[model samples]
Target: MLTQLNHIRARRADLRRDIDVVHSFEAWEESCVPSYCHPNWLAAYVSWIRLFRAAELARTIVPAPARILDFGSSVGELGHLVSEGGAGYDFVESDQHSADYLVSRLPGARRVTLEDAPEGGYDQLFAIDSLEHNENYAELLEVLAGKLAPGGVLILSGPTENRLYRLGRRIAGFDGHYHETTIYAIEAVAERLLARRAVRQVLPVAPLFRISAWARKS
Candidate 1:
């Protein structure tokens, strides 16, 4: 148990270092305003940390060199970390401006639209913070799951059904426009996924503000 705990700590340290490297990139700096809408570096930093942790959790299920698809990859922030382990990363972004920006930021990663996504199926699929934004989340999840390879893993991260996150956002003065709508309960989503038998393993990630689910395809 101690060894496992130490390993988790080491992994977190590595993720932090990776996020630091991402912050140092010229493209990351250039895309800040368009991505976050303002120059709130602290908020952006926290976002990166959350994304990094999500990616790390995904890595535990889907190892390196696997094909990865990031749905609604705004500016490809999480894609950067997921792609680092020699994975074939492809991202879908509906917003043309954000898609175009990602082209320069994520050089090798493929920038695709929902329609243009490859049919071959991906070994790992990420929908970090994207599910909450969609009203037709159930349909979207089904569509995404259909595109996953057999035994592939799906990683989802979003704000929990807690008011504290909203309060914190207000206190931090972060942009609230995108978060105006209600977010679905993370546990409800997980239960739905389990009921469908689409995923064999549905593991929940920690950190109360945001919750991550690692679901291995059945």
Candidate 2:
């Protein structure tokens, strides 16, 4: 774990030399992935571990030889992990700076627009900390579900927005103003289009964030 954190810190330093990696949530609302490399342990831990935890769950549920799409993938960190896991990777990043950074780092990983994401192409679709930022998250869920191949999984990770989550956000130096909704609301609509398969909490105690996997309903 220490080795991984060291690697991420080094990578963050290297990336910041040429591009902007958002340190605080206020700087760039769209791309806060860089906060994973933050010096503050609490902030960095909360930011990065969700991806690791989500990826852990994904590996357990998603079959091998997978094609993965990372929705709202900021700077391709999740794409990096997916590629390392031997999956073919694609991503959607609307922020130009983050997209440019993603391209530079993972040139082999294709970048596709959400609308252009091929139907029934991906075995695993990841929407990590991305969906709740949009007001149209419910509609977005429908589109994401459509992109999955038969029996494929959609992995979602988002803030719980409960009091504990709120306190953690404040402690991590992030204001929760950017989010348009909570994970519960997103999951409420997701239930209509997909069936929940697995769920895990970010922390052992408080449900600060949820990492869940779902499959399209028959």
Candidate 3:
């Protein structure tokens, strides 16, 4: 686990350099900066890679030209990537700043909240790194599952049971703010979904830090 964490940190360093080159410092600061910069910017950079991976994996399941809902979308970065593949997306974010940013960045995407999310179903739903933030994640999962079209897929990913990772974050002074609201165990939630037959498969997204479960609603 330590080795894996080190690998992630190294990769994050590389990505940070790439981001610097691709985006002006001011632009990157505005859109990509994290609240805490202590112990480096690992948390922020790692999130960017994770969201990108989640979006890529989601595309494999839903493909292009499908309707998608990005629940708890922070700045809608993943939704923007998925939309590039010709998918229409509705973004649900509780943060008004993030929602406004999404609207500006993704003009075609609809911005809404969970309560106001469009009725009916979507071809694909993404909750990357957002589930852990919800104290009532299980209930939200059930609600999200109900929003999927027949054979539609829900791509969910978040950190799970990584004591070492948590410790590192704590040492880095990020514990106070990072994942403070995460309460659900990924395994338990996955089991509940499986028992209900709401999810046909629960696949881990390589590296034990995060799990991406592909739940298909029948």
Candidate 4:
């Protein structure tokens, strides 16, 4: 895990050098990429570790070499872990710039549209820190769950939105206007469509994020 984290840090540095950090479109601000590559050690550590935790949680259920889809994958940071495990990686990124960057980083990974994501095509589906941004995350979760093959797992992680989480976001300089709901709300809806397998609290001491795994109900 340490080795993987180092590799991610290096790649994040490369991304910072390659991409525009202060763009007018707010894309940079919208992306967690900046946070991952933040010069401030604490900010960067928090952002990168969250993805690490999410991917680590995923590996517990969806072992390597499985067909995987990273929904709303931002520039495909998780693709590093997916590729390392020899999994067939696919991603859906609505932001064209991020999508192009993701392709550049993980050329082997397929880029699929949300509507075109093959149903029952993936053995594992991930929606880390992405679903809560959408008001229709419940409907989106249902559709994403459908893309999973029988016995497949859907791994998720998002802000807890508790006071602690809100405080952290403010400290990090984000108002979190993009988030339509909280991870708690998302999980509540997920329980209706999938059976919960496991749950972990990120930064268990402070408990800012929730990482969960679920499978389609039998």
Candidate 5:
């Protein structure tokens, strides 16, 4: 186990050093994929799924048309799952490089554009850690509110500042600046985005330091 972990750590070491944003499809395909480094597939998978825990939780809520969105979908993990039913999967990604990667993974899903996202709109909305990648966290829910069909479901997942996160970062030697925010500390941050009468559900992905929240229109 230790040996395997070491291998993953080495790969992550390379991925951690730079933040030169990937700018285009060509660069993403030719350069990004080659440079894409992940140390542990299991940990990576957990992180990928953590981003969209909201989508899964949304399943418990009822909606119409079931239109879905994978916000900030890197390499398309959520897209791949959505494509299983060939449902309407809208992958909204700002990074052209990662978006391109998502396109390849989700050939059937449509590219969800910000303009196309309607107000009070989608029947089913889900995104993983992708929401945090953007600057306007509050604006995100407002946009989704309009896009959802009435009585729709919204699922979103990300980290909650906790002891597990600290340990994970220490073990992986990766930065946790963005993920360490406590959900309780900023509890109202998301509450402010929601409708007054909606139903909500919450789940914790332990050790992963992940939280998924589900809200249903009233």
Candidate 6:
């Protein structure tokens, strides 16, 4: 069942998603950053390839599902990969331009209605590089915690601002980009947050400096 709105927003207000910072590809399209980021997401592909590793970790834990919700998904990059893995997924994006490109892939992606997400209990939920966009990151996590099915898993990947990825860029010489809540230390910090939130597990399996945790509701 979906959580109530005002209460949910109020709960979301308590969390702070400060920077810990920091994905792959179909054809490089300005509208679809996720697909454009695909090739760069996997290991040994992009120059700074930890992003790809993040996707890998998520793929490893998220089992095949009848229904999947790819939150903040851009142009279905990882969504398509998961689909190929034998799971059906629904890509959710707030931006219509990007969502339009994603729909080209599925030919059925509906526009995200902010009041509530696509209905039904999904087996999997993913929010990559997305939490910071919320008030900080807490509100987003609260919503995510409420979204999962009893045993479903939610995968979140992001940088803790300026700290995690920028230092990595020094050695790699990649240009620094902007991210709201980037963290250089995710393993310890994220593990703590996940535990308090009542998430069943916190697995940091990635080449990326941030985090990719699998939270299951029991």
Best by lDDT: 4
> Candidate 6: misplaced stretches above 4 Å?
1-56, 84-87, 118-120, 162-164, 167-178, 183-208
For TM-score, candidate 2 versus 4, the one ahead is 4
Residue 211 displacement (Å), model 6: 3.3
Error of 2 at 32 (Å): 1.9
Per-residue lDDT tens digits for candidate 6, residues 71-123, read 77755555544555324666667666557656665665444542466433666
Query: How displaced is residue 27 in candidate 1, in Å?
Result: 18
Residue runs of model 3 more than 4 Å from their true location after superposition: 1-44, 85-87, 176-184, 194-208
RMSD of each: 7.3, 2.3, 7.1, 1.8, 7.4, 12.8
Query: Residue-wise lDDT of candidate 2 within 88-174, one digit each (tens)?
Result: 888998887788878888877888998888998998899999999999999899999899898788999998999988887777667
Worst 10-residue lDDT window for candidate 4 reads: 20-29
**On residues 87-153, what C-alpha lDDT tens digit does candidate 3 reach at each position?**
4788787766657766765788887667776555687787776777656778887777767776566
- List, in order, the clash count of every candidate structure: 0, 0, 0, 0, 20, 35
> What clash pairs does model 3 have?
none
TM for every model, in the order presented, reads 0.68, 0.90, 0.68, 0.93, 0.66, 0.59
lDDT for residue 75 in candidate 6, whole number 0-100: 50
- Model 4 RMSD in angstroms: 1.8
Residues 141-163 of candidate 1 have per-residue lDDT tens digits of: 76776667766667766665356
Candidates 1 and 6, the one with greater TM-score: 1
Minimum summed lDDT over a 10-residue window in model 2 is located at 21-30
In Å, residue 60's CA in model 6 sits off its true spot by 4.0
lDDT of 4: 0.82
Give lDDT tens digits, candidate 5, residues 27-110.
433222322343556546455344334444555565234567666665555554444543677777776666665565456777
